[model samples]
Target: MNSNRVRAVLVAVTAVASVLGAPDQATAEPAARGGTQWKCGFYPTPGDPQGTTARYFHCAYNHIMIRVHWSNGASHLGCIEPWENHPFWRDGGNVVVNAYFVPVTPRVLIAPSGRRVCAASQPTG
Candidate 1:
């Protein structure tokens, strides 16, 4: 019985490790135009009473499209249509930016541009 238990535990540990260590699989090549993709989670703003952070996945090429999935059963679909018009892009020219969600806030900030940053803290009523 002890040997069986040990073997079961080893199998479980190996399965967990494999799942955590596996790399994301994407059909499109990373270098292909409009094919770059990143998956990241946003954290809640600091000092917020409610500890809720929005999670998002972003895909970009000519523009940025973010799918924000909130913990409160709500979601937001946003896009930086004029990403090139942003001052940060002025220097970089047409560029795709990656953004991570801030904790307790519903804001997304440009990872490179560092401009037009907005924070949406959990609503207090």
Candidate 2:
């Protein structure tokens, strides 16, 4: 897709996820065997030359889409490749950004507990 279109999609998905709120834990799909889990934290947005951090960050389990919510009542939908342990995509200024999937090595086995999505993101700066 064109850059503008892609950005619009991102913004729309993020907005929708934010408005809909967190997924039901009882309904959340079980984490796949050997799913890659990245350490949750505040990381730079895609294509950010200045390494601008988002309000919250976390990769989805397997290929399932996840909603990572922010403190300011915003959220974004993103997912990570279950097969890869390293960063998945690079910033082409549209689709993906620097270390967008797994900015660092996989550490935690599960996302932090919360009624909210990607709760209490730790700063990785």
Candidate 3:
């Protein structure tokens, strides 16, 4: 191959390799420390004309739902609901839902129940 053609091929290969070599470059780390985790309960707040309004209770076990926010600017929602007898909600009564925001790609973890949602800043395991 001509010297110029070879150089061009080398450059192309190097570019491709660089891209393949760093798949995580575009994504952030997951579950990094210093991130914020919220543990709250979802319950109907009294006095609402609607009778019940879901509110964050600052406790997990009693929470009807849980959400996580990661320091990496990511968040994840629990897959279990407090009313659904989820393994996470076994202790029910005044339960505090635990959630942490992870710094990773695909930053959201929605519960299978579709009632909970979480988001992350990066990809996580």
Candidate 4:
């Protein structure tokens, strides 16, 4: 290829890149602290969760679901309780929830259920 042709190709590539924003891992996800940074990418899949209404963010976590983590690698039945005090809100050692359950409720279940959160959601598990 001639010098001008090569230059033109390079310019086109740059233009395309500018049009499509680059991936930002740092701001995309949070880290464990002192540990390596969390991998970049959408932890949970995109799209609105079921039962999400125009008042979504205002009302979160309609139902109560508990996720138990076992040191020996086993799943436990959920514990029910008021928000914030529930075990489902926090993370445990050696085990982690498939996704972070976002439980927020201004009042009762008359509104939409809360959304389940994630880190970087890929097509395949």
Best-matching candidate per lDDT: 2
Q: Judged by lDDT relative to the true structure, which candidate is superior, 2 or 3? A: 2
On residues 1-125, what C-alpha lDDT tens digit does candidate 2 reach at each position?
34344335554653454457534332343354237333453343555454543323333443333444343333344443233222222334322222333344322223334333321222231
lDDT of 4 by residue, 1-125 (tens): 33243235434543443345423212322321236322321132223253211110111223333333333354432212222222112122332223223333212221122322221111111
* Overall lDDT per candidate, in order of appearance: 0.30, 0.36, 0.32, 0.27
Q: What TM-score would you give candidate 2 relative to the actual structure?
A: 0.26
Please give each candidate's TM-score: 0.22, 0.26, 0.18, 0.21
Best by TM-score: 2
- Looking at candidate 1, what is the lDDT of residue 49? 40
Local distance difference test, candidate 3: 0.32
Q: Model 2, which residues run further than 4 Å from truth?
A: 22-125
Off by over 4 Å in 1: 1-41, 48-62, 81-125
- Inter-residue clash pairs, candidate 2: none
Better of 1 and 4 by lDDT: 1
Q: Candidate 4 — worst ten consecutive residues by lDDT sum?
A: 51-60
Better lDDT candidate (2, 4)? 2
Candidate 3 structure, TM-score to reference:
0.18
On TM-score, the stronger of 2 and 4 is 2
